[model samples]
Target chain A: MKYTIFPGCLISYRFPEYEKSAKLILQKLEVEFIPVDSFSCCGSQVLESIDDEKMVLLNARNLAIAQELDIGSIITLCGSCTHILKKSLIKLHDNKILKRINKKLRLIGLKFFPKKKIEIIHIAEFLNKKEIFQKFQNLVVKKLEINIAVQNPCMVLRPSSISNLELKDRKIIRNLLTSTGITASSYRYMNRCCGGTMLAFDDSIAKDLGKLRYKELQKSGANILAVGCPNCQLMYSIYQNMLVDDVVPSIFFTQLLGLSIGFSQKDMEIDKNINTEIISNILNNSIKNNG
Target chain B: MNECKECGACTNACPLNEYDENYIVYKIFFGPEKDFKLWTRCCSCFLCEENCPYGLNPREEIFKIRRNSDRSNIPPRIIKYYENIKRTGFVFNIDEYVNEERIEYGLVKLNLDRIKSEVNKLFNI
Candidate 1:
């Protein structure tokens, strides 16, 4: 369970709670984390779309940092980071690309040898690893009774061919919810894009997509939405106010697990959430019921 | 080897395409070679490729265009993000709020000076 952690731009800046909750849960589970410094952005879709080589270089530099640490496997909290890093890793496997990148790396005193490849594991896949979920499931003192819906971001689930992900991540999220005694709500738009990519280009369109998912979750009786990607959480969480109807609070999957592992509301930074009162109410009600 | 029938099914399935069908349609009709200012609109969601009936990944075509396009015409925010990475070795450079938050999380404050030096040596920035 030992690996290097890559907390991409958003988690490090706008949403450090994901890092905090993740670090706490991973520490409790005895999973060793080696933090790599001097890491850059994931070269998100926008960066990649403008100049593919720059994106590749940025991602490769991050991978090289892990390789320098002698860490065989790397885990990321952001789905976009996981997708971009995994894509870069696969691309670097080509001898020509490796040679080209290594030439640039040599200038920085770094080298990416194709012979020694590193395994890129997303946090979802890391937790889904054989019986690990079961171990966490057994530790839940209070199973959440609120209706929880899961948003399977495109990077985490669909376009499976390029993602290079093998785990049934969406099912794992569902199972994680169900095992923790939380009701897993499934809706038609569960697999739909949250319009995150379009948020920067056309916010109206992004909000439209977010509103669609929000309505579906409401129709399914879900009060809280759990997501694994920071971008997805960012979209739905912010869209709550933009929507006129009842809007469910969106939380990171790690934060959902944090509650079961005994992390308090403050520890998970639930207050910083836009719709913090929703989750706080759920926790308060759970306490009242247990009392 | 010729599987694609140019049915535009990929465009029909794309989430971003729903925002503006003409953008994707324009790309498909006239590959990524032309300087389509709206090229940055593609979110890299890969939905269109997944729904493609011909198994042709239009994303690759877009990527080819992006790779060859001039870097100067991209959005200002994206340019700033790249500059931040080159100068600070971070996409969002450490600020007072970020420093305070890092301390709260029990994480070490990043040595911006050291990181910048290392990045300069690496990226020649």
Candidate 2:
């Protein structure tokens, strides 16, 4: 019912629509949450690769803040943030590392007491656990009948260990969409990286890799691409114009659910997305047909 | 015998390998030598690490080599992210633009001063 919302750094700054849509939908669902506004970055895969120690310490500080807020769980929409924060929380089990980090935090009057019962969950996990789909079904005024191809971000679903891949958030998302009369499908490279991590290092490779996956997603004949990770949305939506024709534009999975639950396109900030026209048309046609 | 098994599993499973197999093979052999533009093609998917029969972490191996070998070769954007975090205590500094967006969406402007001081003390930056 209540959790601390960690917007991470990138989503809060670069893509505030994710925060806006999530806030609006969660408000409608009556999920009580206070934003972790001062939280630092999650030490993304790039930082982890460069300096594992700093990555652990940085994320430990964020978790300490959650403990400060006295919340048992924190919900994050960015897959990379979820992965990094969850993985770092798991690393705190080592008493030696905990002591080291606590020593550092003590300098700032912040201390991370290991085993504080803090849970870092992806938004998909949070919604699935809270049965948000049933709430959406209860509140739906208009059902948007659209076929969506879902991109399961690697950080969110793969390597199966640190991430709650066993929970199969993909299935939860599909079920959630279906509850609102929308159908979802998977295309090739659904599990492949969307080049989100590599985008900073190699833009060309990142675009090509996303293009490879988008081309396959195009074949799925789904008009809209639904994704669990903000990075996946960033990859597909940012590169929409350069990608193949009829390339399904990406939106956060929650945005689509918000649409079904009676929020208009403006409420979800669909127009701010790079492929606005395509998504706008899809929404318009759905409204026309249902009306 | 190369501490790598030469199993070619990484080459087979990598997404970038689909773009150029010979280039990846060569990068694996000579590494940090030859043209590294091809080396920059790795997308960090870790699929190769997952599929490697020998349990060798080729992804880390390649990234380690790249990190140690070049200064200028490091991506400017990644360096920018580091600088921003070091100076502002977050990956992104709270600029007027971001502050405006936050206010527009009914979210409060983030006060990074506390986190910034904490980061300064912790990292000695």
Candidate 3:
């Protein structure tokens, strides 16, 4: 199946490895990705504070561009983008205030018909498809054999619309890890937020929340925290170092998957990771313990 | 509305009261002056809204509080950041911190000038 890719801001600029590995994994499964041209930010965190009309217009414009390309579904790498776009789409379809905003969008020559259905799936969800998972299973040349805690931040779970699918996401990750002969330990608060909402407004609170999760995962005896979204990864990484006394490390789930598939840590760009040394130790320990 | 009994069950159950004993949900429901400061701490987890004796969404009430409060009371930096976003369409100066090492990993750099122009045109700023 083909999907129009929306890299969002963070993945496009800050965490490109996510986009790279995402594209690689999707291609390995033969899923076609059509990049949407002339796309703008999905107004993730900004929309919550700014005027609702502006958020609707910006997201609708992107959706309009997707419609222009005749691609109905847009896959996103960032959970924030997915939540924002999905919420905006729902509002555009259900609220008249948003309808007027779409009309205003037409003044800019960007006509947005809210009736068009645009499916926004997180990259993790797209990869979780049985066929894709099977292909991913076949590609694993080396076993990860590591115990990792999965952190699903609030942006991924809030708004309920997008996160409702995440229950299955937890299962998908478990299944993929087991298939690769990895020991994936499920821990409590797996679905808790990383306190990212307060990152900008209150860094101390965000740090405290991050430290809380770090301690929880540390107690779980997981060496690394595997995540799907970059924002979550960034927050966890920050907490692991600046807040939690550098006790545990955080890595993107795709990075771990890429490594287990015999992709070099450098090839996966894992070497550039701030927590690379700790992660390396974990991988080494997992391998040594398994043998 | 039958789902909500107006028993103020959610108000009593709220954790916000622990932070500020006077920060009760009934005060929000009855008082004319809405103190959003009490509600801003809400995680938006919808636990109170979901558990409401009445189907009333307490989260919506918190949102109303946020809307009614003086925008100036918001952290100046966050306010400025939002203004920049609304005016420029891009998160302002986002490219300056785009770690160069990230570019080598096949990460796409956003055309901030293009995003700024688009947002400016849309907002007529």
Task: Compare the candidates by TM-score and give the number of the best one.
Answer: 1
The window of 10 residues in a row where model 1 chain B has the poorest summed lDDT is: B23-32
CA error at residue A242 for candidate 1, angstroms: 3.6
lDDT of 1 at B67: 61
Q: Return the lDDT, model 2, position A240.
A: 55
**Where does candidate 3 clash, by residue pair?**
B3-B54, B3-B55, B4-B53, B4-B54, B4-B55, B5-B54
Provide fnat values for all models in the order shown.
0.41, 0.46, 0.17
lDDT of 2 by residue, A121-220 (tens): 7777667765665675688777886888777666666445566566445465666777778877777766667777667677777777777787788788
Better of 2 and 3 by lDDT: 2
Worst 10-residue lDDT window for candidate 2 chain B reads B30-39
State the C-alpha lDDT per candidate.
0.72, 0.73, 0.66
Tens-digit lDDT string for candidate 1 (A89-155): 8889888888878788777777776677688877777787777676776667776667888877677
**By DockQ, is 2 or 3 better?**
2
What DockQ values do the models have?
0.46, 0.46, 0.35
Give every collision pair in model 1: none
* Alpha-carbon DockQ of candidate 2: 0.46
- The per-prediction tally of clashing pairs is 0, 0, 6
Better of 1 and 3 by TM-score: 1
Q: Give the TM-scores of the predictions, in the order they appear.
A: 0.89, 0.88, 0.85
Q: Candidate 3, residues A173-248: lDDT per residue as tens digits?
A: 4555567776766666566556565566666656666666676787887767777777777787755677767466
